[model samples]
Target: MRKIYVIGIGAGDPDHLTLQAAKAIGRTDVFFLLDKGETKQSLVDLRERMIRGYSTPRRRIVEGRDPDRDRAPADYTGTIADWRTRRSQVIEDLIAEHLKDEETGSFLVWGDPSLYDSTIAILDEILGRGAITFEYEVIPGVSSVSALAAKHRIGLNRVGQPFQVTTGRRLAEGWPEGADDVVVMLDAQQAFTGHPDAEIYWGAYLGTEDELLASGRVADVADEILSTRAEARERHGWIMDTYLLRRHASD
Candidate 1:
């Protein structure tokens, strides 16, 4: 039997690798990194750099292609189900080919796996297939939401105020009802437009030297954030960003 370890590498900095995550990387026989084509090659490169910086025990690096699923499917739920099935198959094949004799294999994920990451869910699908009997472990790392909050020097949640974390698509559809604070991730559509009255704090390429940060009322700074994000993406060929929006309390 083999074991699968899902480790979060944090946003974009190698230093964000947790001590426990580093230890796990060192012990794993193989490391699986997702490659989202050429545009997002930096993400894969960052993972490689982190492994080198830690001088972890020698391990093989396996590159896996991301299956870009259609986001605007007529049947969203059905499309997602199909996509996950295919994704699980690819992952299962990769693990079998690379870790046939190894007792433990690892996959490096961005941010904490528990937050908006599909790696664990995909792993579960693989397990369901009974293709491999494996124990599982998760090594957490600093999430982009935490890094964004720290970079802006603002607390994610106020005293006694509840917060919700969601994706750009959800925000664009409609601001989540009844949430005082909303943390938005995986946003390429500038979802802040939906909450024109909320205060917004945005950060891009966080933890990297080229990081960009901005904040203000959503109505006031939404355009600036979109413009800055586009420029940064063009300049760096890649960008990983996260933001927070809060509905002001009535006095």
Candidate 2:
């Protein structure tokens, strides 16, 4: 059976990579990368740097073109399902052609694979078909949620309180009942705009040289975040951001 390591490479900072993740990377004979496109080439470059810096000198890097996802699909769930199916097929072909029996291959996932990432789910689907036989392990690393808290110097949850992690779309529907603390990701609309009084700790392009941070009552710095995010996206051709929101905190 072929061995595969689904390693979490951290949010953005090279320093965020865990020793375990580095070790896993070093063991890989081939590192599989899903090319998102030229717009996000910086991401591709960073991954390349990490592999060069940490992995064995002779390791091979395989690049597969990512299947495009519809950003504004009218049927969101169905569209995502189709995209994932396409992605899984691409990955299946990549593995079958590029890797040999007893050789190790790896996927360097952004942030912890357990959080928000679809790589693991897609891999599971591929395995369920039983067309490929491989042993796999997941290596955990620092997530953007943790990075957001560290950059802000704030705890995710208040004492005796719980925080919910959600996406911008779900948040737009409504805040979770009785949830006072929230961490929002993949938010393109500045979802916190409606709650102007809420305290927001936001970070964009986190851990990279172009990293941006903003915090204050949402009303005061909401525009800053939006403008900064827009400008960064325009400048870099891409951006990844996360924010923590506290509706009402005890002083």
The lDDT values for all models are 0.84, 0.90
Candidate of highest lDDT:
2
* The candidate that achieves the highest TM-score relative to the unseen native structure: 2
Can you give the TM-score per candidate against the true fold?
0.93, 0.97
* Model 2 TM-score on a 0 to 1 scale: 0.97
Score residue 43 of candidate 2 by CA lDDT: 89
Residues 128-194, candidate 1, lDDT per residue (tens digit)?
8887767789999889998999899999999988899998888888878777899998787778887
Candidate 2, residues 1-251: lDDT per residue as tens digits? 89999999888999999999999988999999999989998888988999999889779999999999889889999999999999999999999999999999999988899999988899899999999978889999789999989998999999898999999888888777667999999987777898888889999878888889999999899888888888898988888999998987542
lDDT of 1 at 67: 83
lDDT of 2 at 154: 93
